[model samples]
Target: MAMTHLQPDPSPYPADAFAAFELLSSAILVIDDDGLIRYANAPAEDLFEVSVRQLYAVQAGDLFRDGEQLRQSLEEARRHLFADKRQILEIDRLGREPTQVSVTVVALDGQPWPALIELREIEQQLKVDREERLLEQAQANRELLRNLAHEIKNPLGGLRGAAQLLEAELSDPALIEYTQVIIQEADRLQTLVDRLLVPHRAPRIVGDVNIHEVCERVRSLVLAEYPNGLRIVRDYDAAIPEFRGDKAQLIQAVLNVVRNAAEALSARIAAGDAEITLRTRVARQVTLAKQRFRLALELHVMDNGPGIPPELLDRIFHPLVSGREGGSGLGLTLTQTFVQQHEGVIECDSRPGLTDFRLLLPLP
Candidate 1:
């Protein structure tokens, strides 16, 4: 159904009636007793992706994908139940993905409007909750990996020593070669175990860090490696100030991200159209690591790769969770650890032809 072209009559209330609603972060809707939306606030316009003109006179129930529950709640309100009630609802925007919103119905008593509706994006709240869970999970993973690595290290040393002694006792060259293989494989396992233990060791080294310089260093290193078919683009903001962090670790973190992107773009690289963009901007009044900062920096690493697989995207930061074959999968886990050490967060967004890894860090 199309929105009715009916206009609101303002004579029943003060001229500044909706002024307070525009200031609120919550999306608000003023509905008449007929259940038609009389007015929608700025936040409502944004949340619904519709203008006030379009929402005006539209039945409030029509906005939701399944709004029968909403209609009942409104009926309850019109019967003089002025108590506020809240429930979750899904809104299907035209040609856009459906959005989940927490809706609260507040019944108005003997006023210009019969009801007031409030909408809040539940996904945004879930993101904050998910970040907290991720931080806790990462810490526990570090402790577990550290203990496991240490336990394996001692036995691995003894096993390699026994293999060497066995080789010394063997006179036949063929038998000695078998012992050498055992020793070589043992050393390889030891190296992998040490890498697993590295995150638990080496405290974060902190100093004045220029983010742009870090990006430049990683850019040069990556370009040197993929000089033939890949390109690294820089779109940086000069306003980002220096922050106290481990410059080396930050470089490693960026390098890991860029290198991963390059690897994912191997197909595109062979096609001679591979590209990775390093874009930076200053983020103001942002939240990271459960703390709100007046200023933060956003570093976006974008690539024209095929993108991460759907199954591996969520677990990309987990140890040994690489998407590519023969991949150790520790790159992103260590990158996450390094970024978290500086009170930052890294998240990825991907589709078929594009992938973006965004890192946010607080600034001094």
Candidate 2:
């Protein structure tokens, strides 16, 4: 989907317009002609790490650590309608980490609002660049996997055929057993190759997808497998609207991640402390890939297990990199592919006891 620049709507204020502000990727602040904050979007709330109600109660100047510099910037913005200046400012909020953000201030022309301010994290810009690199790497990996599969696929048939013919010619049962083993191994490899190519061959079926429903489906499947001790918890925000996506593909993507968590929790499950939480929340002004959405869904799959091994953590999403024995590492690679197909991104954070896999997808 192409992202268009946001222009001032010519129509009179509509009820939906208010809700739409919550979806912007940039944090917006509407300053009254009197230099007070008249309005703030959801991203602004997140950027300042304050609730809208609390944000409204404080003076706009109090938001920045360098109040003097911000005050001067606001003054220049009001005087020059086309003014656009970039600055580094520290956010001020108690109990929250004091983080520096890259801020851009722009003066609005011929409107009730005097000026508007846009705030974005410096780290977020770095992440956007990193995601672009990861995307390029993923494309290369897909091509490599496809070519390698095809190479193995052709010889696989001949190898199996030769094994069958050898088994037929063997007179002694003991000699024939070796040929049978070769045939069985050949069939196993063929199945593995077929699995590797499934996502590329299947057409992406897009439709409206309710995130909680996908979570429920995965929860059911996991519970069926570890019914004794594993616990699946749901923390869903029912207000989140549905978005266009491939339901089956999403289900598969989410299931692969959750199932991996369940497998990792084998020890915890045996001790009755295993837990996986599926949490959903609404994110405002989130940028996925390069496009910014006014609203997006933040889904977190958190597990309590011996977290991902540090040595294998960085390469977890790379094709065929698995920490577990006898495991196929295609799960996260496929999950990342499915999410990217919907213009989304997946991130992971782990320590000794907690691991979180976050999926951010745009809302319709």
Candidate 3:
């Protein structure tokens, strides 16, 4: 949606015509020479979430949430308008929900008969500005993830080979154990690097597959990991249609997210508080990867734990960023890449109390 704003045009009224123009402006309001509101502008309607016609039906004193303060400000504006020729005041309008507005009062050049009061809504402007910043940040992250993953692939192979050679040359059994550790660690790194390259690899197979089957497979694996302490809940919409995708890739993608959630909840599981819910539903008029589809699958992995740490929340999908200690962090990155390959998108929302990872995939 296009953002809305209240902008005032340059006043055509001369200093003497201040009150007259104030009455005509979409923002200006005129009061009795005593500064009681007698007229308001169209824009004031939005500031109060009321009709402009209803504005005058109510007294200015009755319109302010803080009526006494508003009355005081009006009195001050009245005192200053005639003396200084103009004054700026902040007034809070009265209602079940009150609105704060900035009002400017200007005295007419020739007569003190009328005063001008301008109304504006600053809150709406701030909301739009914040959304713009968030969108820009999300875009930058996507680009960074793509570039960083590509850059890390070359050195990873050499490290893996060097560890393997050192493992073969070690003579002492105990010393060889250290080399084996290096080899194991290098192999783990190799797996992560391979995951980073998954998106670039072509899908080996594609066919119609039921999403629920995929979910169930992942659920079984997760349940096996936390058989005693964790609970895996399924909320499936059976009405959802099958989609064309690589079955194995989809399983791996879903498994990665579920496993990560299970890992994150390990402490909670030990305390008997871990609960992971896998929900599937169909979303209409869905958009993924900037393309709109008439219908899409919505998969949610919701966990009840301490939730993701605040500092790492935004970068959760980026390569090598993880909230978990001793985590390689490629799980989510590969999950995202696999989903994206199928023309899907993944989003996450995490706070102290709740964390939800959502995937939207286009249906066949």
Candidate 4:
């Protein structure tokens, strides 16, 4: 909404003054000199989760969770302390996630309404920005690792060969054991290098993939591994149409995510209370890999377990960044790579009791 539009009660300012703001995407609120809400545009009503008439004569600041900060801004507007000020704050919503918004408060010039407040939802914008950064960083990581893998391949093979030859020459059992350790460690590193290079391999086997099929495969695999004490629940969206993607790669991506969730529930597994859910839904007008798509498939792996540590959440998708003690940490990296190959994106959100991993792939 245009904060610059003259605003106030209908009696003081004509109805036409608020006409243009009704079409605005941003939310606009006009407060009288006493800091009471005189008018709210259509967008504002949506933002506040209330009607424009319901907001009338209400204290504008009281609408926010942290109203004191907004109240101070409104007070400043009434006294003409500053022309305009902007701040980021959260808007409280009942039974829903709080909306983070960029609020701009402008002191109107010689108008009946002294304060013009603009609320722009930044959550979606933040998600887009974050997704873009993630894409860029993942690309850089892939390039760096691919180059490193190529450089290490020859030396890694040589190290294993030298250890094997040294072991043959040593008749002494003790010396042979040392060479064996060297060979095993070299092989381990080689395996890791191979995993790092897997994403660089092109020509994925693409086909019309049923998302539920992929989830079922992963679910059965995970349930087999944790069968005694864990439960894998299916919440499939049957209406989701088949999309073109690499079936095997999609299965691997989903497997990695679900397996990770299972691993995280290790503690709960022993107690027989661990649960993992495979939920699928159809999303419309969603953005993935910095590109907007009309339709997309959303697969969520939700778990009730001890969540990922806060320190490692941001880097979980990076190569060699695992939360588990013995984890090689390439699962999520490869998962993201596979999803990105299909013009999709993966996101994670975790807290104390719940951890959710969502994969978004464009639908044909």
Top candidate when judged by lDDT against the true structure: 1
The TM-scores of all predictions, comma-separated, are 0.71, 0.79, 0.56, 0.70
Can you tell me which runs of candidate 4 are displaced by over 4 Å? Answer: 1-120
All candidates' lDDT scores?
0.87, 0.83, 0.68, 0.84
Clashing pairs in 4: 1-26
lDDT by residue (tens digit), candidate 2, 127-152: 87888888788778888888999999
lDDT of 4: 0.84
Error of 3 at 168 (Å): 7.7
Which regions of candidate 3 fall more than 4 Å away from where they truly are? 1-188
In model 1, which residue pairs have backbone atoms overlapping below 3 Å? none
Backbone collision tally, model 1: 0
Error of 1 at 358 (Å): 1.0
Candidate 3 global lDDT: 0.68
RMSD of 4: 7.2
Which residues of candidate 2, in runs, are more than 4 Å off? Answer: 1-24, 27-63, 69-87, 104-118
- Model 1 lDDT-worst window of ten: 1-10
